[model samples]
Target: MSSDLQGDGGPDRPHAQTEGPAPGAAPTPPARRRRNSYRSLTSRLLSADAWVDTALWRAGRTIGEGMRSYDRFLRRFEVRGFSRAAAELGSDGATFGLLGLLVLLTFAQPAFEATRNADWMTTEDFAVTFLDRFGKEVGRRGIVLNDTVPLEEIPDVLVKATLATEDRRFFEHFGIDIFGTSRAMVENLRARTVVQGGSSLTQQLAKNLFLSNERTLERKVKEAFLALWLEANLSKRQILKLYLDRAYMGGGVFGVTAASEFYFRKNVRELSLAESAMLAGLYKAPTKYAPHINLPAARARANEVLTNMVQSGFMTEGQVIGARRNPAIAVDRSQDQAPDFFLDWAFDEVKKLSRRNPALARDRIVTVRTTLDPALQRQAEQSVDSVLTEFGQARRTREAALVAMVPDGSVRAMVGGRDYGKSQFNRAVDALRQPGSSFKPFVYITAFLNGYSLASVVPDAPVSIGNWSPRNYSRGYAGPITLKEALTRSINTVPVRLSIAVGRPAIIATAYKMGITHELQNTVSLPLGASDVSVIDMTASYAAFANGGLKATPYAILEVRNSAGQILYDRSRNEPEPERILPADKVGELNDILINAVENGTGRRAMVDGVAVAGKTGTTSAYRDAWFVGYTGNFVSAVWFGNDDFSPTDRVTGGTLPALAWQKLMAYAHAGIELTPMPGVDPARLKPAQVARTGDGTPAATQPRILSTRTAEVLGRIGRSLDALGQTASAGEGVAQP
Candidate 1:
């Protein structure tokens, strides 16, 4: 075996016999010598199996000793020595266990700072009741906050219904119900959706009382801790009472007492079982299950609540069968007919006007006497509905808004939308739409302010400002038309020419002075109504002309009074006097032009018989918005029609649906009421026997003719201004028309 090992020619052994190199021959190549050396080294390594075995065995022994030492250390310190150490530290086993619990609590007590805010408890202390011009209840908002009922006053069935649907194990559990939580988790996992919540009543109350509705682990921890504190501090009855009082029931009310009154028109103690179940259903999602909004869905939710009562053993199926069969019916408080839009606007007005009196502002419950005339409001709503029902599908129009107020700015009627329940957005007050030709009156007034009159003539040929060429509605222009005829025809080029002559800033300043609050963009299309303006603002601006150029800022609330009949705010006492914005002569000229338009031009559909009307029609690009804003001696109303998504309609112009609706509403509004002649208008001109004529014994809106010498001088200056404008456009300094 030793010879076999030695003869292997490994690197560790020498060769016994070897041949020498030939004389004068080349030595071995480096590559071939390296191969031989590698083979020898590899063979030597292959023969040393015992070395690898010894190294691994030594390593295993060292690892075993280290592991045994670790185990012994754990046994001594963790098991036996810890007990002795605790005793030395003057702590028994119970004391140490308490310390461990305290450490756990320290980690869980991070949300303790949330308890400092106690203001939420009094959030429902204010309420509002709305009335029309006459003292009849139209609607209620907020709550009768100071009228919180005690627990004993609440009907037993209502309490049981709330507990059954909200928390089945309310009395048995601590703050957090572990069994309920586990059950919820298992059920949610089974269904793959969150059908039920795990929070107890105390947890919900804790959130409503002191926390916001944020879904985070930290918030959940805070909720759990706060719930525990509530349970420890208050009795079960007190917690239940507080939850019932503070929980938000639907329709701008808080607490069951207010909800019962708002929905059933009765007290909490008078709620029947069916009504109780209905109110209980609102606790989950008040808006979703509000009976005033969707009665069928509310009944379905109430049926579910009844089922919950049965499953929770609070009542038998037979006991709940009556409620399930005869579901509750909320009081029919004219949900469809009530002036919700006007009420919403008037409520805001009340809050704003009340700020003048600190005592009035601090009052918890107040009655708002609004300026809304129910008769006119009904007519306005009907007019909008009739138009929509007739032409909505044909025109592809889905929404419309109308605002009607007196010349003095007392809002008489408003129809915000088709239905206030489905959408609370007050379109008349909130929606900003591009007024098409309806905006031309502002331009005409500006022209009058800039020394151009109704008789002043301008060429209506095709015009261009930079790359933007504003085309007329017909995509054609008439040549050399008087300003009266230009406005009467709602032509596009004349306004653009007039805008360039007078400048855009002057026009914007005139519009602002006339009560337009929205900012106007300084674009070439400003005369064409490219900027957005709200319906109310536009109507109020027109009222300036009807009011003999007086500022007619729209207002709704006439008076605000507390529950005790004490007047908190009276508009006549609190509001400032109207300021004159337009000169009487200028107002007369603009009013004459608008009246001519209604009589013989685009707004002919808006004219009411025996009443002098002045208005303008507006239609935007692609037929997106349509408007007809008109005013008589008594009232001013603005009507708009469009799709809510800003989609184009099927060629619905301002003279079509909008004008027709305005005519219907205004006709009805003027039927019984005494008609007041519009300022700057001659009632005699409205007579069929008479015709308005200029100083030359010629009709005001006769055929277009050559410009007079004085007008020629004005046109000459306008031509020079146009040349400068063209130069600016050529220099690439003009803004593109929208």
Candidate 2:
């Protein structure tokens, strides 16, 4: 305010104004006063200029310093934030959380858990009946059960090879190796794809069990989390055990035990280092690296695993070199061609059982011992091939289905088609077609059960219903014939008349009791197989007659075990209930009539050389379907031949292709089995025929009833002449008098 306390040089120099103030006016009244005024003005101007310049310079310097500090702080903060975020992303906590989420998600879905319930099976443990129905699907192969081996029992080679190929730091890592993960990340980034996984054996097991193989950040997070959780919950040895049991190997082999049997037909403990390396190589892609498909690639991968083992100090260099020089490991390809159909069926059963009891459906290995006789299965397949080939050569028919079963409802062999590999459509279980006259047995049996004996007479002449007249296959009736003869000949009119006599509902009920669960039409024509039924159902229903009067449901699996050799379910017959729907005597009678059918009826072609067989032939309208369902003393076989499109086949009768196929199949089935006689009705209980005579033993004016074959022959000649003349044969109008 005062310029250094008004020290402006302290007025030391002369005031240099030098202006002539008013000229000479008063020698300037007091030079001191003027000087003071001038000094005040100068001080005010200097103070104002100094204040403005100093304030501006200080404001500019402050702003520049603030901007520089802010820029430096922002760069440092950003760098630290990014590094923290990356570190957190790779932390154990984050990995564990991710894995926990994946486990929860996997358990949330039914399909993932459903695969666990699939029934497993070995080559034995099946009954002859089961073998007959599904044997063809099995062939002559055996399935080894998946069993856990102790650490000591596991081959050192396998242990070392897997460690070398899958995780070099398996022993050191807690669950995941940070270095391996970083390397994997770098490799993945460079390759622009997920071509590398640095997951340890534990991590891989975690991913397989809890996380999907999907490549995503969220999935990786989940995998990491699960890996940590698995490590915490399970010890290293336990994790390795799980890894060995759950890992996939080539040729449909799922675990180390399965792989050993699949590749070398030996136990897991018996594998050499080279063999272990070969099996370890299958982890990359089991089917792709299967010895059966690509031997060279498999061998190369095995050698690489061996080399890695040597480098990892698990194997000596000489051993690696020796393994590399060894010839390609030989594997039996025959074992690989297992019966897929049986496997599928067993899997279905396993699923059903598991669904019924969910405790057996999770985290357990299951082995199913089924009723599959490999010998019978092979014979069944060969029979199918032979029959199909015979028919194919004659008539380009490439499709056929056959089902063989024991009378106790055990399916032995089933061939859905010629080539199961080309197409997996199981025609035996899926295809539905008309049963044709093969269903007539039920109708006649219904009549027999309803008081009409086998000796009862039925007119096979032209018969008419309300605007619907049924004719015989031969177009001409055999005249008055015995019920036995009518059925043996498969006369349509006799069955139609018999169905009318014994209500249609009675036949339907009988058929249903025999395992014909398919919906049948409530019409008069149902006696001739107007309803659609699957081959399996038809064969099973007929098998009821073979097994006396008790009905047995067809089943394939006897027991199921998990991958850990734990029994998940057992379908054994401790005390199987009998579903009795028919009288034993009636069944026996029906059995007798059916036996006669094969012995001397339309199904005569189904007879084997030395076996007493009984069955029925069915020919539908327009030749749309043909079937032959027959049974030996111990087995029942059903053969169906037709076009898949439901189109008519040219002149393909049930007695033709289907009957021949049944014959060929039965020949193989009865090769070693002995034939037994069917039980028949007691003759003493049957009432003798009542013959009415007119004058001189001539026929009476009443109904000229033809009861026996002798009388039927006389009536048939007269009926043919009368039918030829276009005149209806009235009762008691025989040409020759008796």
Candidate with the greatest TM-score versus the true structure: 1
Worst 10 residues of 1 by lDDT: 700-709
Measured by TM-score, how close is model 2 to the native structure? 0.51
Worst 10 residues of 2 by lDDT: 123-132
Per-residue C-alpha lDDT of model 2 across residues 517-593, encoded as one tens digit per residue = 78888887888788888888888888777777778677776545454545455554332576876777877878778
Candidate-wise lDDT, in order: 0.82, 0.70
Clashing pairs in 1: 437-618, 438-617, 438-618
TM-score of each candidate structure, all chains considered together: 0.68, 0.51
Superposed by TM-score, candidate 2 places the C-alpha of residue 494 at a distance from the truth, in angstroms, of: 2.2
Off by over 4 Å in 1: 1-125, 150-255, 283-294, 309-319, 332-336, 688-738
Q: Give the TM-score of candidate 1.
A: 0.68
| CA shift of 200, model 2, Å | 29
What tens digits encode model 1's per-residue C-alpha lDDT throughout 473-586? 788878899999999999999999999999989889988988789888999898999999999999899999888999998987766778776777777677789998889999
